[model samples]
Target: PAGDGKVTTPTGVTASKVTSGAVVLNWQPSTLTTGDGPIAYKVWSNGQLVATSMGTSVAVSSLLPGQNYTFSVQGYSGTHASAQSAPVSTTTAAAPAQKPVRSAYFDQWGIYENAYYPKNVDTSGAAGKLDVIHYAFANIDPTKLTCFEAVKASDSANESNPNAGDGAGDAYADYQSDYNSGTSVDGSADTWEQPLKGNFNQLRQLKAKYPNLRFTISIGGWTYSKYFSDAAATDASRKTFVSSCIDMFLKGNLPTGVAGDASGGAASAAGIFDGVDIDWEYPGSAGGHTGNHYSPADKQNYTLLLKEFRTQLDALGAAQGKRYILSAALPSGQDKIAQLETDKIGAYLDYADVMSYDMHGSWDAKGPTNHQDPLHDSPADPTTPIAPGTRKYNVDTTLAAYTTGLPEYGIPGGFPANKIVLGIPFYWRGWTGVPAGSNYGLYQSATGPTAAKPLSQEAGLAAWKELNPPAAQTHWDPVTESSWFYDGTNFWTGDTPQAVQARGAYAKSKGLGGLFAFSLENDDASGTMLNSMDGSLR
Candidate 1:
């Protein structure tokens, strides 16, 4: 019992990370005799004991923003308590001017032709502003009917193959491919010994640099969603598919490299993805890419599939002590939304990201060169012979279809507004052979999509940074909250910087979850659109 009341004073105490609501205070373990049983730590804030920790660090949370505080540590062994360590003073960050769920989609193929690497997420300043990055995409196994990460792409050319997504993935770009100093996030060339490489490795680095940011592996897309219906068809299939996804992405059991490369193995990409984003395109409808399987049962089955995912993810999270996220890219068309149990599925999702863009594009190709991503409908627009997307094809109306229960149209039960994420397209849809009208090609007859040289990244489309229309005539439609440009014959429907900022303000005004770019790479090098979105949201 001699000197039982005294222990070694804690040392090397410091505040490692300070934020608006929390401070991460860390200290070295005290040196003492083995007789000191069951050592512990006590955190003192402003000279008062605030918390007891079994570890060397404590996250002192729920503090006032922009306030200064002093943190110290004391070691404990049984009834003995060490003298308090020297206090270290620090200030919590000022309150952030934005909300959570600020997300952006990262296209892995950007490395192929667009030269957009994960490093761009950093240099563009998008990483700092974004809290979530949905990496698009991780493909589903065609034969296995499960989530897969491989290097074999069915259509290597990446042309007009509707089934290009089946069993197709870029493991090369995901992890195996090497990043030179110029292309890497940390400006370090990847060596052979490193287990990870390429975009995925860059993502890991970005995650380290931006501790607040999280990366989610987006499963399926317009091009890669061919098998969602089959995968989510029944209970057995859904269980297998979700488990495979958890194994491949959430668990990171990636393939051991593509073809004959031996640089990769299981768990090579573990801890990279924070969750999964289901981009199934459409559930019960025969929409999206060709040969997509759909059935009348998909309506109920879709909700069931999501429940399976939520149940499994929660189980895994409980075991791992982490809350993994689950979200989906909701169909914008009212008809497509009808096939989804929107009201029910929202309960299983962190947020439902509405594909609000591409409302009108060259895909119509019939006549009117229209706004592809209007925020509202124009009263002067054609009112007769309306189709699903022909009318009410705007951000406001599409989101309304989910949150307001369009009873007149038969879709019932509304989703929560706070759980919706708006989509912002970083690319423009163009058309040519348009007869000049008072609306600058809008609501005017057009022959077809533009014959002009399209952006190499996609066909009949132009990236936001590559829009050029002969010094172009520009116009904005205040009624619809849309903007575009034309040069006599070429018409391109795109969003302006102000338009993007307005959308951000619109999200805040409506109490929406957050905003996401269709693909961050298409934005200008200045990240003007993303910055505008963040600035207004703030």
Candidate 2:
């Protein structure tokens, strides 16, 4: 008599009831030849001969846990060999656990000299929520104390001056003192300010308090961006400037005794500055101080410069067994995109902070000051049109600028969703010329037509309540998805707690990292704005 000539086990042979040292393999029986007696079978483990079997079921013992093993069976037709079934392998399940996610941001002027300490850090009572805080080092007087003290003194002097000093006087004085002064403490030489006094030292304290928090020194902003063009014009200058910056930042040798730690100074420096952020305002555009005459080489050379920085920092980190980060704050316009080779630059960057605010303002001709980012509608409505190209400000425009503006950048990790902190203005914009009954009225500055006029939080809230009280009036702008109180004369452009809630929802929907208010002091003392942001974002 001949045994079955073919072995026909079901596809996907699986093992069930598997334990630490045993497994149960199950499969349908194979067909036997018409004249052959019930075909005998032999089950092999890992394709090796293991044991002969007469039934379809088999329980293998002494198997290792979590080990993958293949199994197959063979049939016999008398003395002739039959085909073997396909092999099946089983794998053990891995233990369950959650992976960690990293977060960072491009904070606007986070390390101001006088205001960068824990005293100003409200923390919303939720300290340690941030993993990385990128301080935009705008207006650093390497020759003078950081710009914070100067700005504070300027503010005080202006408040006391006959004409309040205005903008020109303070700016000129600061420029002269910062650049012309040869004094050691004038901030000419690079040195760490007294402990917890200057921005850098305050940052050191912040890092110490929040062990996981990291800091980055960002260079460049709207006013002082002119130097970047000059520095990048020549290879020698670029190398020299970048090298000096790295050395001053890392070694603190220029102005001795300013560094946070003297013992293991190199390690201390490494600990304080995890990276550097380049905030070249409008690299290729005419706007800001970066100069309007950059050639095509500037764009290409910018990438090379960043690459050089990354290479040098990485070399240092490797030598010291520590890791350093690299990032940049990109312009918020399409014209400036050419200044950076986004694709090449993205590879070397840890994150890119996109300035999504300041897209519209009094710079445009209009009566109502709309939201910086409107969720819907154009700046000017078609029905009661006031100006051309004026619409509600919203994230859609910002996202479009980054996506279509720098498509080649590939923007590793989806436009830095978490790193893409939304810029919220603590102050509001206003104007005259609106109708008496318009909903946009709140308070107007009689002394000045510019948005620089200071508006107190209490006064602003009181005026809004008196004019368009929260109960009677819900400051709603369908066009901007923002609310404002029109007190008949001035058109106040400020955000409410409700508007902030909507912004938080929008940020979450867009997968943004967090929200950053322009100036912390402008918020209500009770911290209505900050608390709202914390609740929504945290």
Candidate 3:
């Protein structure tokens, strides 16, 4: 031991884990210690001493955002100061202010089925106003083992739709259709040999015109969710599925089978999407066909799958210098909610879009008529004994479960309130054979399938655009924050501009991020529902 010799300086001083207001500094232990045995290290930043630590690392905090700073370390021995090691420099990330996400879901099949193509959208007054538009949907091709596929005929469920012929989605509509007229967002002709054409190109054009708009491809809806269980069964499978997804959507890897291979040079779809939105119908429950996979382990595996997606997305975002968003269309039913680790799942998501609608519909043959998207439960008799399982599951209860019940399932205090988006429906559910009453058949017993309306022409369903229910019969329920109408034999339940306004107000008051609807095309051609939503949110 060189007792009188000077102590060696700490080597390899470096800064890691740099954040908005903090930087962690680490250095190799000193080579030569004071005669008193081991030595402490002095961490300095910008020539000013910050901290002295017995260990190799020290965390310095309270730094200003977007400020550049350099750090170095020195080995200390008694009263002697060793020379400072090499300095490491870094700039703190600018802390971004949280903005509310006013988002909506767009259906791709709407182009042909409803004749509501991107061109039909009121870009100046409607689509352009939304912050996020989730395109529905992309499915896992069970045959191809790829998550990307052309929107197929079966994917088109518009049997009564006059605009839809054969019900097969047009790939040409996706990227290479010559609309020549109403399709252009700016009344400009399509650019030949463009990196993308058709609706995808139209969307790109729309985004170009409205730079604030962001788009996400929602994968695995009710019709196409059969493969999610298999895709996320394990880490390797999840990687394969996610890789195929990014390649197809984010990377602009066009399917030759449908759109014909066309890459618009280096700028393909490479950055078209700001993120991926998973619309896996029911992860651990049997909401899908009996052939679909269901298991108790799905609750745990679903969380794991989300973790993998977040890991992969974050890695890609880090490389691309953008933060990719992750979101899910969650089940509104408490039974379906049971399969999710609500508290843990939110950690991986940008937001949770709760499908608060479809709580009751014509699908239930002998069901009690109720508000399909009530903000709160129907007032039940407090004294009357009611089974906890039979409790009315409303929007408030769903929000409470995620924000409150998660603790019982292990996550204390559930998910963040601001990360939840209430989902509403833009269509009405109809039921027939209900006993005539003062409430206009609402919350009453009913048989199935009412006669088709003159507009929607569908027996049991009617889009808001086609729903011209007599204004005199329409009634609003303040308690549930919903609306209903019954004309003698037919009972109708759905959201109106007033109901949507009320829901938006409730969401804002509760600190929720925003509200979303199943399909934008369902709204009136004049943009009635969207205008109401925008007005309420503002």
Give TM per candidate.
Answer: 0.81, 0.58, 0.75
Cα-based lDDT for every prediction: 0.75, 0.47, 0.69
lDDT by residue (tens digit), candidate 2, 204-316: 43443443455666665554454555566666666666666565554332232222221112212223466677777656556654222345577777777677778877775
Using TM-score as the measure, which candidate wins?
A: 1
List pairs with backbone clashes in candidate 3. Answer: 175-197, 175-198, 195-264
The weakest ten consecutive residues by lDDT in model 3 span 380-389
How high is the lDDT of residue 338 in model 1? 80
lDDT of 3 at 414: 78
RMSD of 1: 8.8
Best by lDDT: 1
Candidate 3 lDDT tens digits, 89-154: 988778757655678887876776577767655542776568778887776767444565553465
Ranked by TM-score, the better of candidates 1 and 2 is 1
Q: Write the per-residue lDDT of candidate 1 for residues 1-538, one digit (tens) a residue.
A: 1234357777788877877755677788865555634455666665444444444655554355787878777776645667788888998888887564688899888887678988888998999999788999877777788987677755633535767667777888887887888887767777654555778778866754665677788988877788888888889999999998887776666667466665445555555677789998788887677767788888898899899999998776655434577988888877788888867888999888888888778876756778877787778776342353344666776777788876655677478999899888888888888888877777887778875443444445888888833334778888887888888888888777767887888888889998888889888788888898788777
Residue 125 CA displacement from its true place in model 2, Å:
3.1
Off by over 4 Å in 3: 1-97, 155-170, 191-195, 257-267, 380-390, 406-413, 452-458
On the 0 to 100 scale, the lDDT of residue 369 in model 1 is: 79
Ten contiguous residues with the weakest lDDT in model 2: 165-174
